[model samples]
Target chain A: MQRVPELLVEFYSRPGYLAIIRHMIDTLCGRLGFTPAESSQVCLAVDEALCNVIRHGYDSAPDGRIRLAVHEYSEKGRLEILIEDDAKQVDLDTIRSRDLEDVRPGGLGVHLINEIMDDAVYEHRKEGGMRLLMWKRLPRTAEPAKANQEVDAGES
Target chain B: MQGNHEMQVNTEQRDGATIVRPEGDVDLSSSSTLRTSLQEAHESTEGKLIIDLANVKYMDSSGVATLVECLQLSRRSGTTLLLCQLHERVLSVFQIARLDGVFDIVPSLDEALAH
Candidate 1:
């Protein structure tokens, strides 16, 4: 098995912490040579998973720590991310997609995660709580830095 | 990953385009504001619609769906809908949903309108 770089952080399931989480994801992805689009997807998926853990897993209890483990393999062109929370249990089999016509403005995280990742798994840990495992494959060949450079040049 | 607080949505018009700006966290609690704002934009003008997401700190699937609905409505109405000023976080939601190609996304409102 290959060792993958990881980042772990815990926050009270509150909206304010989302900004920090997003920044951290972007910084980490940038360092790992992820494209802008890929970086965005990872951040969103991770954020949604975290949101679920807080909102549904704990039922908005506002206690305990939510652990995030991110792994990236550049050579294999693969990324794996695991988010775990000990607050409550999530029914993996019961997970359902949010209706589009409902229009009330929430409850679509699971479906979004499933759509982006090559694979998404939900498991209830023996110790307690839920773990969402998400994975995505990178492009087989890295695109030349020409486009990135062009954006950078245009920014200045 | 943090709290489940709600998000707030606001609207504005710029250079013949309607811009919907949302603030706070977008989830089940706050998705209606976004939906209402977009619907209002659709009703108010036949002009292009631009979602300014810079101030939008967070968005979940509920939020993305609202944007998709707006896109669909625009398509039906023959109005251009652009998602502009994408915060890195919000942009992630689009990419995760494989919606990057589904909407017209630009770096900023000016850029979206200019095109």
Candidate 2:
């Protein structure tokens, strides 16, 4: 409900766009006070989600539309992003990641997203698609330069 | 071999080890290319394929999955697989996924080769 900066990006569901999307997420996280490492992890989470949308949601169709809405809460130092796809919706009950003990490929994407993000919610869009919302609580170092009284107040 | 400018993979042979160094961010976009490069490197030698990740600044689960595939392939081929010089960010991904326990990680190429 806070007044936050919101940005929406829409692109084709394709593997080639993953780099651009990752860079965008990383840069935005950095600018919003997330440390490089934090930004990188968030980048990974978003990348994983988008990859899922492009792969599973669209079934690797490449032409399916994908939309990402990023909400930047400057006051609270929290970032929330919503990923939407126009492909067929998936059952939320099946959103859970596979067991790590499996030690296999192709299923780690969902696990990585769940581990990196503080909160992740999946929903079926009314228009017939899937929507994923994720948010993370950043470190106190969210402020690059809080005040002269703050020293060694770096990211954890 | 390079993959769409997002990632470029380099391979080398040393001490009966095939070292694959991927320079760039490995994600869904470039992981397939990396897989190809790794597979080719492993095919060229009976060595322990060493994934030298010093140059990789970032990697996604897809990248990790690609490595997992190679690990399975190496096992089928009766070869050992090792990862060296994983950057902190990339290392954390493996750690989070508990893959660190599954992989033989080394600090450097020399150590990987020594093994």
TM-scores for all candidates: the values are 0.61, 0.88
DockQ of each: 0.23, 0.51
Which CAPRI quality tier does the interface of model 2 achieve? medium
Clashes of 2: 0
lDDT of 2 by residue, A49-92 (tens): 98888888998897999989887654566778999888998888
| Candidate 1 residue lDDT tens string, B1-115 | 3333556677777788877777776764577788888898899765788878877756777678788778778878998888877777677676655677767888967798897
Candidate 1 wrong stretches, greater than 4 Å: A1-5, A73-77, A98-104, A138-156, B1-20, B23-58, B65-115
lDDT of 2 by residue, B1-115 (tens): 1123468998888887788899988888788999999889877977578889998888888899999999999888988899999888889999989999999999988899998
Number of the top DockQ candidate = 2
Top candidate, metric TM-score: 2
